[model samples]
Target: MTASRPAVEIFANPRADRSAPRPGVLTHEARAEAQAAIRAWPGYAPTPLLDLPGLARRLGVAAVRWKDEGGRFGLGSFKALGGAYAVQRLVREHGGDVTFAAATDGNHGRSVAWGAKQAGARAVIYLHAGVSPGREAALRALGAEIVRVAGNYDDSVRQCARAAAERGWQVVSDTAWEGYREVPTAVMAGYSLIAAEAVAQMGAERPTHVLVQGGVGGVAAAICAELREAWGADAPRFVVVEPALAACLLESARRGGRTEIPIAEETVMAGLSCGDPSPLAWEILDTGADDFAAVDDAWVPPAMRLLADGESGDPRVVAGESGVAGLALLLAARERSETWAALGLDAGSRVLLIGTEGATDPEIYREIVGRGADEVAGTVAR
Candidate 1:
């Protein structure tokens, strides 16, 4: 199943029209259906979009809106949306009593494992060789069997794929390739509910811009498609951010096609690491994206520092490397003052960003960002 893989283009210093309109993404019916399905979770918690005024002032932006997915199901990441949707749909489609199984990079696997328990099923997750022991332990605590792969995330995904094929276990994955588009597509659709909620919460004061992190592009695809569809041509400008070392989406934009890379992607932002762009999401983001930016590991520590210092003057938020790195992008854009001008990001501009996860590996988070925010805060309060 070897195929043509293109080198990805990283969009930045964008030369294209910022306001160029794209086609509609999800339909009203599709959105409503997805919303209803999420509501059925019963235990679904309302993740908030905090208005980061202090952070916004620091970034020189009119406003910064954050969709904090920390402590989401006590899992500390946003992958719960995809994992949950994939499990429920898989069980219903194939007929099951509520069990799910998959390999993960910690967050996704745990999300699936947690969702399976909620859906009345069990999950076994596999991981790549280098996954931190802390993450493996966390996944196991969710009651998943953690299998180690020989290589990277995609490699573990392949192992999961083979296992699912042979054992008839459902693989709750976000990335899609040949002959396996439906469930992943559903996962993307499910994630779209996040942006939908953001928009709904904003109401008449919808965000004028969006900055989404890219892994395999499921969350980005969902947001881009939904923004275009729900808001039409006049919607907010869209931008994507990724780790400089693990920017597979940016590589795809360069090659003018979906590109595969060396996968030597060692970075603090493990959540945003992917060697290939999901084909389905690539198709949607090809021309729909406005810009792409890469943040170095250098900026993550500072951003993480800031995420912990919220409006409450306490370290209220905990995030993974990629999660906090998004703040780096927002701050840079605000500093450059060019993207802001180009996108008409004035005082009125309401911009949105995602805190995709909270410390997928607390030990790793402590290592990267200096003593975990949660720990330092607890110590301070005591």
Candidate 2:
């Protein structure tokens, strides 16, 4: 029997201080530097911004724009903009043969490995027990040595930190802690490119609401910071989404501070199964995000299928499990009139959802969507 869906937990941030200054780490100058650097690299085309008229009609919204990052730098995830860029920055600062290490459930590791390969450096990636073999293999194919850890993502992160420090390997983590700010700040700066690209693609037409998935809240914070800087008082309402099973950001928002939760169970959204909120990311998200929504894992498969099937005549998108979190949150929220009204979503609302990754794990994608990513992209016969 199919399992039942859980109630969607929504929390409105009481601390969305619009007058607060933007975080120093992700300032416009930092993004400019990152943009110029990243654009100079090979294969740096901006991902497509797709208009989903049919989806908008169905959802009672004026427009729905999807910033599809599946093809980002040919890495199949928006993480391509962050981890790799941070690695490159480190290589420039250190040396060509400098070693970098990171703990990841998937995409970020691939990005670091890819960056290391480009610079002829060494990459050591750590994965928790829950990460799929397909994801581990992807990192290995990118030329990273994989180390399996004992517990959850947070455990792997601790192990990675210890090992990196002992082995003299620079930790190129996407999540920032107390003392480890510079590298993660650089990572988030690179992620600011997503908002930059989206702003350019939209061309003065700004969304009323932007729903972004939160994994340690890095990408969401980056986007929130960038859009707030770009639009100032006219910034779009930011909604941070995550799996209910691992809603560290939401809990942090509710508590009015950075919070960490224990991961008792792993969600199918492997990329978002993080238990700890990044301290640096929290600095921006505390006041930048308007709301935090955690939706059940049961909503993911259907959302993925919806994007793949293009049920509304929209172009097909190969959004992975974690990639579809924002869409899942939207689907859940619309079903409840209270949530829909609370979010100020209506006939005139222009919604922006980022498809954060493609088929990062083809096996899981095929199992969930019943088709391969290439087939959905029309590259292979369906």
Candidate 3:
């Protein structure tokens, strides 16, 4: 795995707050193209913006909402939004009638495989051994070849990048470096579609803040960047949340310079347990994020259960660990009322947290939620 590239090189302009434009980031035209490509994606769902009235009651906020990405496009996560669009853009520009490849802890690879299938291409997905069998099976069921690597997500990314270089396969990765910005940019752009849809879904009442789950930081950057545009001078407060084991952005932010956190990433939220941020994502986030937070593995599960168990007799939300971990930030935010007080959140403030994934890794989810896979599933469905 590569060390974190300097944020200045990637983003160039860093601002104290996200409201001002950064220098040399994605151009408006490029963003528009990405928006168009994401809309063109087959099986794309403008996912629901769910109201969590009970959770709002708990947080003492006016409202709480979830952007549900579970079971989106048959993959159990939101990473597909970026992965699939990246694959389509790469295949269209670079080559066609060929194969697409990616390395992911779970979601991104599944997305690439799914998109390649739709685009009439083949795919090879590299996964670390930590990935649950359920996720592996899901990829294989989509007709994509799954290769088990022996290390963490960062290791798998390196392995996949090398193999793609040698085997003449196109890689649609969310992480990027000097010469690798093309696909990562497309990936980030594709991911912006989420916030695009989300901003529209909000209508007149915009969210006061967003709690976006960070893996390689692609989706977080995408969502934050679009919010920058949608909200313009008054963009919502952007917070990047991650597993404690892999707070590359948080650690980097602390160092006042870029830092590569070596992650023996041990979390049930495998999707966010990534070591390095995409260079592009790092760039956007370093300048755009108002603050960063990390939560322990213990916080991930109960939150999953809380969502999957439903609130106030509603059907269960079926949020797996990776998805629901985003809301753990809400819990912490409420716990430290002072943290949000300065951000101006009160009962009238609308908060958006992503339910980013479904049951992509059921074993991990069950272990986190302290229930068998089937035990509480019907509750979510009912």
**For residues 77-135, what per-residue lDDT tens digits would candidate 2 score against the true structure?**
99988899999999989987788999999999999999999999999999999999999
Q: Pull out the clashing pairs in model 2.
A: none
Alpha-carbon shift of residue 75 in model 1 (angstroms)? 1.8
TM-score of each: 0.87, 0.97, 0.89
lDDT of 1 at 357: 83
lDDT per residue for candidate 3 within 128-147, as digits (tens), equals 88888888988898889988
Tell me the tens digit of each residue's lDDT in model 1 across 1-382. 0123211223643333435443234445655666679867766767887777776666556778888877566677888788877787777777665345566667788778877776667787888876789888988787777788898888888888998788878878888878888777777777887887787887787777788998888888888877777787776778778777778877778767888876775767877767878888877777778777666666677777777666435335677777875676665455555544654567666778888887778787778667775675452111
Query: What is the Cα-based TM-score of model 2?
Result: 0.97
Q: Return the candidate ranking by lDDT, descending.
A: 2, 3, 1
Q: List the candidates ranked by TM-score, beginning with the highest.
A: 2, 3, 1
- Evaluate residue 136 in candidate 3 and report its C-alpha lDDT on the 0 to 100 scale: 90
Q: If both were scored by TM-score, which would come out higher, candidate 1 or candidate 2?
A: 2
TM-score for candidate 3, residues paired by index: 0.89
